[model samples]
Each structure stands twice: as structure tokens, then as C-alpha cells.
Target: MATVLVIGASRGIGLELVRQYRAAGDRVIATARDDEGMTRLRELGAEPLRIDVAQPASVSGLAWQLDGEEIDVALYVAGVIDRGHATTPPTQSAFDHVMHTNVLGLMQVLPQVMPMVEATGGVFGALSSSMSQIGPVPGSNSWLYRVSKAALNMAVRSARFDYPKARLVVLDPGWVQTDMGGESAPVTVEDSVYGLRRVLASLGADDNGCLIHHDGRRAASW
Candidate 1:
């Protein structure tokens, strides 16, 4: 069975990913910030590691947690959304929280985990949003979130060069129904994670450094 590592798997897309992967009988190591989250992960048959990605000190311990295991699939799925638009300036606290969680956290995690992925010639996928697209820009509903994810896209793409053996890609999970997406979202969490797993399974050398939708459509431009 493939060994999978999911960073930030307490809820939403991340939690659902752990559930599905475990259901498929893969060995899953997932992270959560609190006791309750860890308990939930354990119940789902995942090896739970306590980690708050927004905190550098906490994230620093992840490498030791995994030790020497080679990971077949590693996903950085920790992120927070910002709803404020460009019409008003975002407060420093707001920007810091969003950027730290969405971009900086993943950046910190990569150094610790990418080597594990490389050892297995695995696929490393980060959850990004289509709203991050600059070309044919969508309306600025969550401008700060847009900026953070756009930076996330660049971070993963740039890091891909250093770990050539690992297939690194950014994935857009679509607007799935979750605490972040709300009830109005058309896509279900099950469907979104299913598609994402499919995309991860189908990664090729040429697919490296690309942004792909959950359904497998690749972005034409960054």
C-alpha cells in the first residue's frame, strides 16, 4: 500500500482526504492541531501527528515525526480563507493570518517533507484555488485569499525544480461544500477529494509544476 502524508487534516478537504485514502487501505499519516482532531484521525485509521501549520515551531517537528519513511503521496492542505475584498485595505493581522497559514506554512513544510517524497519518486500536491488565477481574473470576492493562493501556486512551482524526482503540482479542489465553502457550494466533499485522488494517481513527469483541477483539467496559464 502507498504511504500518504496529509498536512492539516482536521476538517474539510484535508479530513475527507484522510478518510478516503484510509478507506482505500493506504497507510496515512495526517496532521491535526488539537486533541479532538487527532482523535478523529485516529478513529479513521490514520497515524495522527499534532501540528499547527501556522506555527513554525510546531511545523519544525514534522520531519522527526515521519523520521525515515518514504512518502508516496504528500499533500499540503492547510489554509485559511479571507473574505475581504480590495475595496478596503486588509488589516495587518488579517493579512498575516491568511498569508502565514496559506503560503508560509506550506513553504516550511516542503523542506521537511519533499525529501521523503523524492525518495519514493512520489507526487506532492498542494491545495490551491482556481480563483488564484491571474489570467482572465475572476471577480475580487476574496482578494486577499486570491493573492495568498497565487503566491502558493508560485511557491510549489518554484520548489519543484529542487526536487526533480518528485512530481509537484497545485490542485484546485473546486467549491466544495464545507465549513469554508458553505452550504451553497455545488460540489460535495466526497466528489472533490475523489477527483483529487484520481489526479494525484495519474501524475506524469510532464505534469510536474502544473496547476490542475480536481477533474484533471490542467491550467493553460499560471
Candidate 2:
């Protein structure tokens, strides 16, 4: 079984990932903002630690805590979505905060977990959205969220090259019906995560730079 570490394991895609990994009998080092909130993950046989991805101190502390643990898979599912555009002219604080939480956040997160995966010759995965694709040209709205995710995709691509021995999948779980995706999205957490697992499980060293979607298909720009 693989040893997996998931940051932002409190709810939504992060929470679902913890459940699926445990159900598959993989050992998980799951993290959330609080112990009380992540009790479900603990009950499912994961060791849940408190990690708020927005804080660099929390993430760095976690790196030290799991310094020697060989992690087979590390999934970064912690992301923020602020839907507004240049048209709306969002407050400076809101725009920057969203970018900080998503773009700058992912940059900080990857380095801390890379050592764990590198130790075991393992893989890494990070969630990106279709909105992030500059090639596709999304309709409207989601200015900051889309831009941050697009930058995240670039970060994943760069990491893929840097960590050539390990397989890295830059994933888009689709329009999932989680809190972030809301009720209107077509894909459920189960459907999205299950499909994503299949895609990740099938990857090899050559798939390191892939930007994959939930249905086992690769993204257009990938």
C-alpha cells in the first residue's frame, strides 16, 4: 500500500480524497485546520494533523514533523475560488487574498512535500481546474481564481521537470459538486475522485507532466 499525504483534508475534494485513500487501505497523513474537524479522517485510519495551507509556518512545521516519512503520493487539494472579474473591479484585498491563497500557496506547498516523495521514488498530484486553461478561453467571471489556477498549472509543469524520476499528474477533477463547485456542477465527489484515482494509478514516469481530467482523459493544453 502507498503512504499518502493530503493537505487541506477538512472538507470538499480534500476530505473525499482522504476517505478514498483510506478505503483502499493506503496509510494517509491527512491534515486540516483543527483536530476536531478532521476526526472523521482519523476514524477512517488516517493520522490527521492540523495544517492550514494558507500559513507558511503551518506547512513548514509539517515538513519537519514528517521529515523522515517516505510518502508515496502527495495530493494538493487546498485551493480558494473567488468569482469576480476585472469588470466588477473587486476590492484590492479580495483579489490579492485569493491569489495568495491559491497561487503563492501552491508554490510554498510543493517544496515541503517534495522531499518525502523523492525519498520513496513516488508521485505527486495537484488539483487544477478547466478554468485555468489559457488555451481554452473560458467565458467570463472568475478572474482571480482562473488566473491563480493557470499559474498553478505552470508550477506543476516546472516541478514535473525538476522531479523527473517521479510521476506527477496535474489534475482537474472537473466541475465537482462540492462546496466550491456548489450544487450546479455536474460531477459528484465520488465520481470525480474515483476517476482521478484511476488516472493517477495508471501514470508512469513518462506521464510526469500530464494535465489530466477526471474521465481518464488529458487536458487539451497538456
RMSD per model, one decimal? 0.7, 1.5
For 16-66, candidate 2 gives per-residue lDDT tens digits of 888998989999998888867578778778888887777766666877778
How would you encode candidate 1's per-residue C-alpha lDDT over 1-222 as one tens digit per residue?
999999999999999999999999999999999999999999999999999988888998999999999999999999999998789899999999899999989999999999999999999999999999999686878999999999999999999999988899999999999999999999999999999999999988889999999999999987
Worst 10 residues of 1 by lDDT: 132-141
lDDT of each: 0.94, 0.83
Q: Which numbered prediction scores highest in TM-score against the true structure? A: 1
Q: TM per model? A: 0.98, 0.94
Q: How does residue 33 of candidate 2 score in lDDT?
A: 83
Model 1, residue 140: C-alpha shift (Å): 1.8
